[model samples]
Target chain A: MDFTGIVVVAGNYGSGKTETAINLAAACRKTGMAVNIADLDLVNPYFRTREARIPLEALGIKVILPDRQYHFADLPILSPAVADILRQQSDLTILDAGGDDVGVTVLAALASVLKDKSVRMLQVINVFRPFTNDVAGCIKIQQEIEASAKLHITGLVSNANLLDETTPEHIYRGYDLVQKVAAQTGLPVEFITAGQKVLPLLDMHRFSCPVLPIDRKLLPPWKRI
Target chain B: MAKVLMKGNEAIGEAAIRAGCKNYFAYPITPQSEVAEYLVKRLPEEGGVFLQGESEVAVGYMIFGAAGAGERVMTTSSSPGISLMSEALSYIAAAQCPAVFVNIVRGGPGLGGILPSQGDYFQATKGGGHGDYHLLVMAPDGVQEAVEMTMLAFTLAEKYRGPVMIMGDGLIGQMMEPVEFPDDLKTEPTNKDDWATNGMDTRKSKKRNLVKSLFLDPAALNDNNLALKAKYEQMKKEEVRFELYNSDTDYQVLITSYGTMSRVCRTAIDMLKEEGIEVAMLRPKTLFPFPEKAVFDAAAKDSCKAVISIEMSMGQMVEDVERCVKGQRPVEFYGECGGDIPSPEKIIDIIKGLL
Candidate 1:
């Protein structure tokens, strides 16, 4: 799994895109790549990539969030540092976009900066979600996201999960749905994400793409230490 | 009526649509926001109305106004959002409008954490707003139960001509479970020609109908209060609902719980039974017009040694439990607040201590 250049993770809400983005940044850092993750998610204030900033930074992954005072603000206060990162490409730069077309519209502001670079926008698909349950629904979301973000999705990431109750079947079912989506949208299945516990239980050969094992960094306030 | 896996929040939205509720007005709050999101697209496809109000306070009045005009309307919110809607809820209750409110409650006194909590017990059962009115509050334990309760909420709201509330915790809202909406539960909106403030020309008699909560005269206000009290009393007799688990045989301890906490108690009861500890659970499906008699009867069992109330709050429902026991036995309370769910092992420890 070579995560080079700028990778944007976008998906519908609760599709586990933030978790995938966090883990992808961590994965790139483990390979000695200089990774930086910009929290471009202004849609959801609760479960954004910035919530796991401390540990992500501990992995030597630089996290660029909104201005310090506006960390928890719902406003899309993009830091100038994100533009600097996009201008000077690092080993791996990840832009974790917010959920849905409304969230991805923030990317249109940086579209020109991202236009010249080799950008990979991965649409994280969770078939269990209400809107993206079927292939047509997934395609419709993909088209809307591309139109709003002013960039086409390069690949798909199957992130089918049901929180604590997620099983191997959920992952496989998501993989199958994304495969169909990939066929329809002409995008490759970049990878499938699962929690560290469920990864070993999954048959890796069944999926065409590699499996990215996720570390649970995003937790509710009560679950945090 | 095929079974499909769905989050509790989305399931409740579908259930509302199935129950003939075409109008939905709500502000997005954590846990319950999915209900509004799901309906925003679905209701439009179903030729229904969906609107995200500027705030929960505004959404509550939106529901009241819509319901007053003879539409089956509803709103969904969390704890703090529901607090904002309490004022409109009181107005709706006073106006005798049929509307439904779903509170996928999170922990809160004010701006509390967005996690599962049954802390809104008093707000839903007792009046949260400044009034002496009660909403028909139903608590469902799982996704399927949440759907069923939401459907029932519409009917009960119309039958009693008042607001009905379906209370669920964040766990019930976020969790995924296979649910099938029963086709038999499909319903038509209750006819409101006589009382509803629809256009006067639409009425057969061509008479004007006004829906307002304000009563200028003291006697009229008093009469309205008396009528509401009578309706509440009638609900107490006819609408009290509960379920008894493992109560067929004699038990050493009786546990009282509701909603998601009740499901946790069931798991605890199964664990305790394996260790030769006999326990019975009495779960009230309706919080308002609470199944007080059922709780009293369960606690008064000959073999029951103690009664304990388990909740996802700081002993809110325990007050009701104690009232039911009435010193017949030792009553205890165990709870966890601020989004921390009580584990089955912890519950068993509490039960053993009581024994």
Candidate 2:
């Protein structure tokens, strides 16, 4: 559960990876530690970590994205700043990659640099999403992430949510799925993310891992509070 | 069945399958590729086919080929991809083949941006291709409406025997919301054998149906244009769907908007109502068979002093709003075509300016 060193977060599409990564960086920074979050997502065109850069930067956390030339594109281009941050042996550096194996393939480009440092690669699992809805599906995603990134996943983040309609039961069920996957893979359940609405309603003692209460930053302009 | 949370793109793919459409063809594009990703895995399980063609142009013809044979077919694409499919769309419409095309519109003059935009309003409502034809365009305001409209697209396509479109923006495609697949939207394709090239033996008829869009003779082409005109007219009469928000009370500003843009307007309306400023909104669900009368009537309200077309585009829909209001009330336009959607506060400011 320690938010130290380089933390790489990968997940299936719609697995709440970007939101969790953004919140994770913000959470780590809240402890008075300098945090830098990099957006290496080359898969999704919208609703990525870069979209919330303004607010994240306003929180005194550094937000890195691809160069302005290929910013909106799903190109294989990775910013040099990301490499610089990866080499920085300081406070928390979270990398939010795109979803699925294809999404994390960009991590393989950083594999050479990653091999030099001890990185905590975490796979976010949302049991409600189509691919990671079950134990086998979660394991498959974990294996895919491991294979494509050429790195081992040290932890799992149970991020089962239904946007504005999320309830306590959803978080509970998500915690159960992450526990099952953790038991099977022997990886630690790093944390569980519940949004502002359902955070108060959840029974905190039921979850073994630490809870990260995330403010929904990546939303449509209309839905934003 | 219980409500499941789904991205609008994935919901659209599932809704088509539930509608008994077993054939789907598409080329990947931003904000809408998830529909293809979800269907490529799920379609085969239902004994349906999902094909990702080399290009949107190729995929559009694949849909045309399947629909020409009386098979329910569909394709999903973004703005640029939809533009590539326009030629085939015109061909399919001319041949009277029933097909559904989903344009999860991103910004564009050409590949403008991958964020949500209503720039395709003119492209969808008016003819994108070279023809005197119109697509039955349904604009959904959210993921749930996207699902319902996607399912209904197949039935309406068969009913009119022409292309129907689910005109969604990128936000609608990428965002997640709880949705239920209604059993009522599940429908069998109807009236196909009468005109489709479904084969003589399949329809149990000795006559072989030839599906062609060409009418070389001048008289024949005029008749074909008239027939297309008749179908569009019928759609205007029976299929015009509009939602009047806060219309029961007399409001000053009448907002004409659709899809995700209207959702923001709805929130703004509620916020404005709390401030004792009542503003009504007329949301047109069908773009081609636009709720012109509804818009005019809503604008004609005694207290209504102004009508504004609030969209995610740079005044693409404002032209239609101006025509519908007929200059009775002063018409205004407000938009942002680049990726950032106009916020409710920004919308409130615009509405306040009109007052």
Candidate 3:
């Protein structure tokens, strides 16, 4: 089987990290691969992989979250059970890392297990976030997260958005900012995610790799509209 | 029949297949994801539908939808995911939809640790979700019970037109032990087509079976709840499962425990016995509609001095044990929270103190 390795999604707060993770997992599933998603977003818990579990299960994709006692507003403690899933060779496993450096601490426990595996740790950049508004700031946040996790960032996900009202121009600016940060950090720009409506308007030729589409399912069911 | 060492999580998925459960919907949480991963491939091979739900909230609804169709369906999660599922579990129960839900409990008041813990006993047995309802909860201690109970859960759910829960903990989900699925057992074909909303057929009469928890009138809602309570009372006669160990003598101490913690209690019982202490244990396999008669009988014993409730949480199942033993015996309790699995040695020590 062509193992797509483990996609570790890490980024600053409100960077749409979980959304990117979910949609990317969905994109992979659409290509006829077995996909298993682990909701490791220990940060702001309200919008995470677990929120999308039902639809994912409907698609024959597997989703892993914490148990019932673990609510949305708690620190993420990665279970060793997650390591067992990571070691499996058949499917593509997506780790939807929580927002911010503290949230990424959950992965620090897996440094040894991740050593030989095909793992891609990507840092998502949202220019709208407090500290990571600029290219240098994005790079700085990436270093802080990488230092804390003891893992290098392999790629950059440009998920620039303006909350419930993200426009094509905002996505373009976010992509440009991440492109520069990618150059400085020596990380590849893996994908640029645009709202489904903006997908047709953007120039796909400006970046390398695939331009993954982002649906609105990452939003809370009440906030979806 | 081939028997191999399997974890509680893997056993749940495997048993669902063995039970002829044709549809599975789930969101993975620690200690329980294996249930989902194991089924990802096995379900397709078994000619079943395996869906990775978008969220625990949605997975619960998906199970509700699939079960509503008269298909044998199941979903598994740990504590946090189970919390999200409580709403759906309630709806399924109120709707009398047949399905199986497995909760591999972990420690917590909030995001707690990821180790095995039975903190969800009250939520699970006393109706984790809203409304006046209860799920037919089966607490499995070992891998064999986990697999066997899950299969039984499917049958019981369909038989009662209600939901059944397989409540285990992280230790059970992760621990591996030998399991044997009965070869003579086969899944009975469901007559779901009689009521399932599997697209309209003009040949059938127009009888729409709406599975919802919503009831507009207070009187009707009370009636529904009372009817549900009656159903539970009837279930008490048909489904209360328990295992009595070392109870042949007039024991000075009676230990009531269930699930993974009960396995630890079993070892503790052996140690207590070795020390010339006569102790008896009643491990409840069915938590809800608890083994009341077995507990009452054990408490009525003149030799059984005290009842100590052993659990992984801070005295949750102890409530039910107390309710059963009533004032007939002094019920004591010992436990640890936040994903801590109490050792058999700890239980032995606790028992010694009671003596």
DockQ of each: 0.15, 0.61, 0.02
Docking class of 3: incorrect
Candidate whose TM-score is highest? 2
Evaluated on CA atoms against the true complex, candidate 3 attains a DockQ of: 0.02
What order do you get sorting by DockQ, best first? 2, 1, 3
Candidate 1 chain B weakest ten by summed lDDT: B182-191
lDDT of 1 by residue, A1-225 (tens): 988999999987667788899999998899899999999987765667777988998899989998887864556688888999999858999999988898899899997788889999999988777788889989889889999999999999998876556789988999999999988878889998998778889888898899999888875322322
Between prediction 2 and prediction 3, the one with superior DockQ is: 2
Candidate 1 residue B196 C-alpha distance from true site, Å? 1.5
Please provide TM-scores, in order, for all candidate models, with all chains considered together.
0.81, 0.96, 0.62
Candidate 3, residues A1-225: lDDT per residue as tens digits? Answer: 123878898997557777888888888898899988888876543446787898888887788878755643355566556788888874689898876677788788887888888788888887654457788778777888888888888888887765445667777888889878877877788887887877787777766657788886753111213
Worst 10 residues of 2 chain B by lDDT: B184-193
Model 2 alpha-carbon miss at residue B60, Å: 2.0
User: Quick one: ranking by TM-score, best first?
Assistant: 2, 1, 3
Candidate 3 wrong stretches, greater than 4 Å = A1-225, B184-191
Summarize candidate 2's per-residue lDDT along A1-225 as a digit string, tens digits: 578889999988778889999998888888898999999888888788888999999999999998887877756778999988888776889999988898999998988888878789888988887778899999998898889988899999999887888889989999999999999999999999999999999888897779999898987777656
